[model samples]
Target: VFFHNALPFVGFGFLDNAIMIAAGTQIELSIGVVLGISTMAAAALGNLVSDLAGLGLAGYVEALASRLGLSIPDLTPKQADMWQTRLSAHLGKAIGVTIGCILGMFPLLFFGDEEEKLEEKN
Candidate 1:
């Protein structure tokens, strides 16, 4: 679960770093907005994929354990529900980051002084 939760953060950090190096001070506000939106979308989609894969793997592991006659602890219904929720949230974050990074790379439109102003307002 720890690893699962950490995946999106790691992915987003990488995306952010890539964007910063690619754009730097040359980025504009419009480009930043576009990048932010795109990265978010992509991160969300990617997170969903990751969540599904993790769930699938967990299911497989449980099944294998059962087949091997090993005693596996059953997850509480609430725990399962919470896990799903967290997975969805992580996925959404990942999509956001992916979209943001891609759009952020546009120097003329995204990484501008106006963006800093907007950010300050937030």
Candidate 2:
């Protein structure tokens, strides 16, 4: 049950964080500079993009999880409805997402700060 909930969310968190970071860096370097928007504003726009992409890609994420052979556990309806079961699933998802988001921060390693570069030039 934990794996069933956790695995797919790992993918979701990875995608969400990766896209947000990549897009935010791009926007900060380009549109944010041109329009004089703050880095935070660029990040907000990047989050918007990530959210829209998530809505479109949710099915694909689920399908990929299925392909990985994680099926729902064969619990009886009563067992599935137990509080312990629910708690395990929730904990699994939270932990999985945290791990995935950490992994997704790999993008930050590749991007340099454009503002720093500009400052050095001046």
Candidate 3:
């Protein structure tokens, strides 16, 4: 869950790096667009990798518990539904990171440092 939540921040960092490089190079508009798209793609791929890693870790823990003969309580239907809801919420966050990265690349679209600092304070 922590990994899922952190993916977007990681994506944002990558986007920042891409922007910095683009600014330094004074790339043409066309190249800037291309770089933005590539950066977004990379961010999405990174998020997907993080999600897969989380799933794998969860599976490993489940397997370990089973091997240890631990009696895990069976979740009721409602509980199962709730768990799925929470998982989906995290999944949405990962998706949001992908979308946000793409959007943030545009001028006036990215959040400034002041905005981020305010968010952090909150």
**Candidate 3: 10-residue stretch with minimal lDDT:** 24-33
TM-score of 2: 0.93
In order, the Cα lDDT scores of the candidates are 0.50, 0.90, 0.49
Which 10 consecutive residues of model 2 have the lowest summed lDDT?
113-122
What are the root-mean-square deviations of the candidates from the true structure over C-alphas? 12.5, 1.4, 12.5
RMSD of 2: 1.4
The candidate that wins on TM-score is 2
In TM-score terms, candidate 1 sits at 0.28
Best by lDDT: 2
Off by over 4 Å in 2: 113-115, 119-122
Better of 1 and 2 by lDDT: 2
Estimate the overall C-alpha local distance difference test score of candidate 3. 0.49
Order the candidates by lDDT, highest first — what do you get? Answer: 2, 1, 3
Question: How many clashing pairs does model 1 include?
Answer: 24
Q: After superposition, how far is residue 54 of candidate 1 from its true place, in Å?
A: 29
Runs of candidate 3 with Cα error greater than 4 angstroms are: 1-81, 107-122
